[model samples]
Target: MKKKLLNQPTFLLGTIITSIMLLMTFIGFFYTPYDPTQMDNSNKLAGCSLEHIMGCDNFGRDIFSRVLQGMGNTFLIAVATVTIGVVCGILLGAFTGYFGGWIDEVIMRIIDVIFAFPSILLALVFVSIFGTGKYNVVFALGIAFIPSFARIVRSEFIKYKDMDYVKSARLAGVSDLRIMFVHILPNTMTVLLSSIMIGFNNAVLSEAGMSYLGIGVQPPDASLGSMLSEAQSYLFSAPNYAIFPGVMIILLVLGFSLMADGLKSR
Candidate 1:
């Protein structure tokens, strides 16, 4: 059954695309065809050639190298944001759901308030206050994402907290923490995993949007969003500047979406 599900076209394609991007990100840590940050005005806006496969940006930085480096930056921010959201969100949600009292009401109300604002707007506010940087972007996006993850985890915990195994664990004199973390949490893994993938996809997109708006990773650090923002003016003359990064962002998001769908199907 597992093998059959893995063989499904959506799952296979997602895995392949995600693996390629992951490989690119890993390789980018050690090497790129040229220095991604180095500028060469003499070769600025050059088209694809044997020397520079993805061509050059207006600043003459190798687009291929920049894209490779940007992959690492983008993935790093997404992973960090998702990690923060999952850890903090799950703990808060599980406690609220399992306890279910004034505590739950208070927490849910706070979450509701957060949800009242669109995520991008919240992110913009955070960036504006905290100032623009890579870590700031991660922090902003992670905080903005907390409400959704918390809601999902809270629902999952509510469903599983009353299950037989959980009750048995409680009757066995197990601590509430133990029941929540050990007994209840494992049962929620399917939903949690699905939420995690979706959160990661959203994180990536949010970071890109923030960066494009000039509130994300700043200059000299290549990010897919910043790359697109920079290439906008050069759209007509150096279309590859916009094209490569734009395609990369699409592929990244598509890979995660397909993976989430595949997992949910199982």
Candidate 2:
């Protein structure tokens, strides 16, 4: 069943959307209709036409250009958040799982405490205290996701630690680091890859949520979240404004989710 789903055209469409968004990220760096941060008072609220494919925003800025630029900003935030979370999770989980003692107890307890609150709520708290900005948003999102990565990696480590190769590595006087990396880490990678993919998707959504609340990337910086927030006010007259960014987010998330599921099944 999973194989059939993997083979389907919808999955291909998701893949294509994700690929195109990434392509736009790099392509947008060198080209855009106008600087996304620049405002044109005269062009404000211009409707879709030959001059503006997606139309102009309330500020008369090009919606299509902003969306393109926003994709780049969004990609960077997602990559940073996920990279930090996954790396921290892997190291902490390895230490806790491989050495299982007071170390494991303390780490797990801390993870449990962090998990007690809803992630977005926790992030909101951080954002509120730090004030809204790009770094704050990234930090809030990264920290919010740490516990899940830690827990997942810890579980993977626990499963692989008892395997014969690990036991042999220990007996052979392989350094603990060597055993963890040379033996355990590689074995746990399948699960980790899937976790990272899901983490990437979550990072995208989390950033959007923060932006919607005015805590994410500031205005003038294009991001799907900020774009959606701006479009909400014009949904009646410029439905395409909301629709395009919304679909981009959905497709990006769906692609990663599907790829994660496929890897897990294998």
Candidate 3:
């Protein structure tokens, strides 16, 4: 059943689409048809043509080039956010789980408090406080996700703390750090990887959302969210403007989701 599910068409498509997008992102770093940020006001809003594929945006920047570059920025933000959330979460969870008592209660309470608010709202609040930019957006998104990752790690720790291996390590006078990382962490990797994948997808979406709302990565840097936001105003006439970035976002999200599911099933 698991193998069949992993081999499904949707899964394959997700994988392929994600790979291609990622490839484009790397390729974009070195070469593209034109500068993604360049504005040619004279040629603004041109339709797809031999010279300008994917049309020109309102500012006359090549949509294709901008989209590719935007994907790259999106990837950067997602990676940073996930890394921050995961590392901090794991450390906090391990401490709270292994030590228990007041430590666990304090950590769990913090997680509860953060989780009380919707993540998006929390992100918005952070972004507003910090001011808008790529770094600020990543920081906001990362902070928003810490509670989830911490909670998951705490659960894993609670589940495995009393196993025979842990007991043996404890009796052998293994350092708490060693026991946590060497004995416990390895067991948690499967769940951690799945959680990180979920985090990745959420980070991308959240960053895109903030950008669309004009509170995220600034102009001069093409972001899928920013593009979509701009496209919204011209929906009736330039439906393609919104459609392309929207599809890319969906593809990326679906890709992470499928890969996460595959890992969990394994």
Query: Number of clashing residue pairs in every model?
Result: 0, 3, 0
Ranking by lDDT: 1, 3, 2
- 20: Cα error in model 3, Å: 1.5
lDDT of 2 at 35: 73
Give each prediction's root-mean-square deviation over alpha carbons. Answer: 1.1, 2.7, 2.3
Q: Give candidate 2's error at residue 206 in angstroms.
A: 0.7
Clashing pairs in 1: none
Superior by lDDT: candidate 1 or candidate 3: 1
Q: List the residue pairs that clash in candidate 3.
A: none
Tens digits of per-residue lDDT for model 1, 49-164: 99998999988999999999998999999999999889889988999999999999999999899889988898888878978799888887888888888999899999888888
lDDT of 2 by residue, 1-266 (tens): 65675576655555666787788778888899777767789988778788778878888888888888887788899999998898888898999988899989998999899888887898889888988888887887888788899998888888889889888889999999988877889888888888898899999998888788778989878799989998999999878788878888887798888777767766
Candidate 1 wrongly placed segments (more than 4 Å): none
Q: Is candidate 1 or candidate 2 better by lDDT?
A: 1
> What residue runs in model 2 are displaced by over 4 Å at the alpha carbon?
1-14
Q: For each candidate, what is the lDDT?
A: 0.89, 0.84, 0.86
What residue runs in model 3 are displaced by over 4 Å at the alpha carbon?
1-13
Candidates sorted by TM-score, descending order? 1, 3, 2
Better candidate number, 2 or 3, judged by TM-score: 3
lDDT of 3 by residue, 135-254 (tens): 988888888889999989988998888999999999999998999989999999889988898899999998898898898879978899999999998887777678778888888888
Query: TM-score: which candidate is best?
Result: 1
Candidate No. with top lDDT:
1
